[model samples]
Target: MTTYNTADHSDFVRQLYAFAAHIRDPKKNPCPEALEERRMKIYRELFYNNVESFISSSFPVLRQIMMHERWHGMIRDYFANHLSHTPLFPEIPREFLKYLDHERIAQPDDPPFILELAHYEWVELALSISDEKVEIATINPKGDLLDGIPVISPFAWSLSYRFPVHKISPDFQPRAPEATQTNLIVYRDADFAVHFIEINAVTARLLQLISSNDHKSARTLLQQISVELNHVQADVVVRGGMEILSDLRKRQVILGVRV
Candidate 1:
């Protein structure tokens, strides 16, 4: 009997990886032409269906908004070309987001906010499954809402996109805003379902400051915004913004201060 040497074993392993890649890409396969054709039909159906299901569950609205052909084509392109970080099924959605962030699939004719909308759609599933646990610190929720704030939850993320993604609908297909920017807040609430909040520029900046532990007072944050929108009153802005912060606190989204 002949024994396979290390070099032979290595070659076999390399080919296995290559075969897996080819199975993933409908354009490539290692089997004989007739057999390869049959195998590919099964491979393509299973691979595409799994990814499509994962993405549909994560972004139902986005899936609904896209034409079936367009959605299938995008998923096929992603499965064949995008490099995934994990083989785990649950991680596929995150990999899909990573693919969108890096892949410039947005055509000029496509909605300007297509990528943002995809992300907005994915945020809910990502937060629902996020394993990161927040350690809520003790702080006086009633304590001067403006004074010496601590930290935001690691699980909470604030984002800005150039498109008003939240407004997208089958009827209201969005274009890039004339204003040039839109802001969003994605946070896990006490119930653990992710909530998406559309916020204005000032509130976005204030949350950014608080998240960064900038140690700035609410007045200072409003003043910073006031500098941009000349002639606006900091006091009025702070008062309005505090209401948001207070609500965030009540929801347990703001995880209290570090002190």
Candidate 2:
């Protein structure tokens, strides 16, 4: 058996750290002298490529809208910095979002809506892979949305952004934030397909109420919203809320009323 001294073990650990550091950021960290340069080159490329590929897939719309060099540079920054909380590959998108949200320093050329776009794309990926299962039988498919307690699907997410993230693509990247905030409900249907619907502030608030309350009927929630809105004709608000509720049910944002 080969017995290693403490000094030898310390040196080996230092070398490992150096190797990882260099792989994460060759421009800043020096490669370990013990590493073969040719082999290290292959290793570094493989590791960076894998991280870049995962991020690229996770934020396809963000990738599409960004300049190629800028996008890769951002990925390299993420690869070199953000320490992920989980080891799962499926969680990389969430990790990347963390990097974007807290780690990254924005660049002059980067889109104003970059973070929102990345988040929106991440939302779709999250809904597709989420483990939360919805039981259709517990919900009444034909129940009156206004009379019965409206049930927001576990897979449905109500999101609000300063930019129209869903509308972002290579063709239309807004240089500045929109005057009004964009509200969206992204949901996974019975077939497990992720979809998004743009909604107004009232609709967003109604969904928020549904998510927070289990005892309130849709009509009750809408009436509260009308009072909040200070609408002169509360009945008009309720009628509009009913129409939106019916539409949301069809879209799977509201799965149905609870049994």
Candidate 3:
């Protein structure tokens, strides 16, 4: 009887990955010849389509604009080159974001705002599925905005991007930055519905202060903002800050004061 080399078992795994890698990006790596061609082709189609579906759903806008060939090529490149940290299927979009952030380079044909737009889309999906919880019992839902310490909701995220990511589409691609920066808060409410709100620099700064220093009362936050903006009138800033905080609370962006 002929003895099969025991060492071939380890090599088999290496060969299988090599075969799949080639299928992912044939131009970058040659297909393995030892495997049956038809079987390899089946494996290729299944793997690529699985990854492609998730990417397409995650980035629908990005999908609609690109030519099918170019889009497939990019997806193949992602599958071949990127090493994802998570094995969970729902988290693939986040892994793709990491790939775009670190590994993938922007092609000449890709829009300048591709990264920001993808990030915006991912944020919506992320917030929608997030299971993080916050204490509601200790919070005073109708607390005074000026005197109470505002607690930011666990679901609230204050994001600043160079591009107006919410408005980006294939038809309206902007090549340069606008004079004003894009400041947005993406939050999930008590009903578990995610909402987006655009805020000015002053309000964004106030949220930043609240997040960074949870110990500070809303009045103290407003005072710090007054100093930062060099506003001669402190009371005016405090009054304006109250209105902003109250509006945010009504929208469930702020989960009321710590009681």
Candidate 4:
């Protein structure tokens, strides 16, 4: 193996980082004087355009709702400032979600539901591309959901947002949060189709319970929720929850009992 001089290696690494920084934010950082402007221009456009395209596809609705200047401005900020942890193109949206969640502060021009909308869009993309697979042999599909433990699918994600992100679109963007928080479950069905449905608080709580408990029967889980709610009729809560479980099973949100 041929080893290079340590000082030369360090200088090369520094030059490489400087080249990347200029490409990432050309307005703020100048490229090396030795580099050709035409070649650097191509690199800048190619890098920024690729990132922008992935982001546009991931959050199509959000893209449609925002003005071009505002949307591209946000994307540019993410491309320039976000320290993305992944090198894969598919994971770029996840990095953008992190930037919105932690790094980028909300601006006066940003939609009130910007973060929630981005998160909602990211869930659909995540479920579609997730590698988690269910083993059919381990699950007893015919088992009684109420009498036996029910298994929530890894694809069923329970999300609670301050705004109704599912309903936001170019035509119906709300300016303020609604009267109540919006609860939703986004899941992938047997056909590999991803779907999102608005759910009530009770249904969201039931999904949460199914996710956390491996031994509790559906009836027992419902009873716990009833006690938490201080409901006058525990039996009524159980009955309602059982019906909801059956519906969720039909949707493939509950994969079956852990048998």
Candidate 5:
């Protein structure tokens, strides 16, 4: 006949979290003593492997370049430290990006382009499963884009990063940011295939203006760009912008003009 401490149950739960935390990053926390070593090892491996699999699938390029030890350490730190806002498994990759953006401090050995590359990879995955919808009937695929209001596709995104994220790979990681910014548009086509196109500063600004949906026609938007850019030849700028709009329509980035 023995009396159990009321705190014992709570203590066990706390210890379980502690042990799990330690399993994620042993350097930062201690292992629980209550669990058998063999069984704890199994729990640790199982949990770490599942997380590693998700991260690896989401960021295949990052995984290939990082040595196992460093990659595992980074993942472990994320698992242990980040307090994710969402509990959904599908959002883990996005949450990991948030952690990298907001929480993770840069390590001397870590590539400077790591955050940008991770963001680029995450955007691909995010757009792939996006539930956003648009009505095709409202768009005029062959409309005069210059005079008509250009409607940006719901699936299109114009992203600018300090690093040339699209080009970074294991073999071509850059230690420093390029002098010029990298501007890219990632869009899902009619076939549902996601693709990215590199664009210049003016085009990037034009997309931003179009996204405002301010009841401005494509010609007006282009004019605004030309004025803001202080181009010597506004008509030339507008004409070039018109061609760009036509190409964007073909790519489905600009979902034609609103009728």
Candidate 6:
């Protein structure tokens, strides 16, 4: 009997790849009409339905807008083209969003804001399932609230989008706003449920700077915003901004400001 060497194993591996690919999509195989045709139908349907159900459950609102055919087509294309990072079925939604971020789907042209909206939509469940716990260090609440650095929760996310996705209603499918952008702060409250708050540019900057571990004083943060606005006196903005910071600290939104 002849022994099979590495070259023989390599040939076997290539053939195996071909066989598996053919079984995955039997239409790609040049097998007998009866043999491959029967299996192709079952395989295709199973693949399409599984992905469709996964996406539909995760993005019910997006599913509601598209017709059945259109929705399934999107999933079909995603499964066929997108390179998934995880083998776990539950991670499919995350992979789908990753695909959407890069792949142009076959529907109403998804605006730039659509990516952010999808992420925002997905975050509710993502946060619920996330295993990473935030360990916030203790801070003196009565001390210089601005002096202590504020650390936003690791799970918390701040997003600004061209469209007001959160405000989307049955009657109104939000289009990209022409006037100004909207900012949203998504954070898990003390109760552990995720909450979203609509915030202004100033507040967004303040939170972002604090999260960045920037060493600027709360007074400096306000002064910077005031100068950027070319407002009257810096003290007025600083005083008001400190009050806002104090409220944020009280709410536990700002972990703490070092004195």
- Candidate 4: C-alpha RMSD after superposition: 3.8
Candidate 2: tens digits of C-alpha lDDT, residues 11-104 = 8776777788888888888777888899999999999999899888888888888788988888888888788779898999999998888989
Worst 10-residue lDDT window for candidate 4 reads 1-10
Return the lDDT, model 2, position 91: 95
Sorted on TM-score, best first, the list reads 4, 2, 3, 5, 1, 6
lDDT of 2 at 20: 82
Q: Model 6: how far is 95 from its true place, Å?
A: 1.7
Q: lDDT value for candidate 5? A: 0.86
Whole-model lDDT per candidate? 0.71, 0.87, 0.86, 0.88, 0.86, 0.68
Sum up the clashes in candidate 1.
1
| Model number with the top lDDT | 4
Candidate 3 on 90-197: residue-level lDDT in tens?
999999889888888778888788888889889989999999978889888888778888889989999999989888777888888788899999999888899999
Q: How high is each candidate's TM-score? A: 0.80, 0.91, 0.90, 0.93, 0.88, 0.78
- Model 1 per-residue lDDT tens digits across residues 96-172: 88887897476556666667787887777777888886654465445566665646666678888777787788888
Worst 10 residues of 5 by lDDT: 1-10
What candidate 4 gets wrong by more than 4 Å, as runs, is: 1-11
Q: Candidate 6 regions off by >4 Å?
A: 1-44, 105-113, 138-143
Candidate number that wins on lDDT, 2 or 3: 2
Comparing 5 and 6 on lDDT, the stronger one: 5
Candidate 4 clash figure, as a count: 0
Off by over 4 Å in 2: 1-11, 135-138
Q: On a 0 to 1 TM-score scale, where does candidate 2 land against the true structure?
A: 0.91
Candidate 4, clashing residue pairs?
none
| Tens digits of lDDT, candidate 4, 60-93 | 9989998999889888888888887678989998
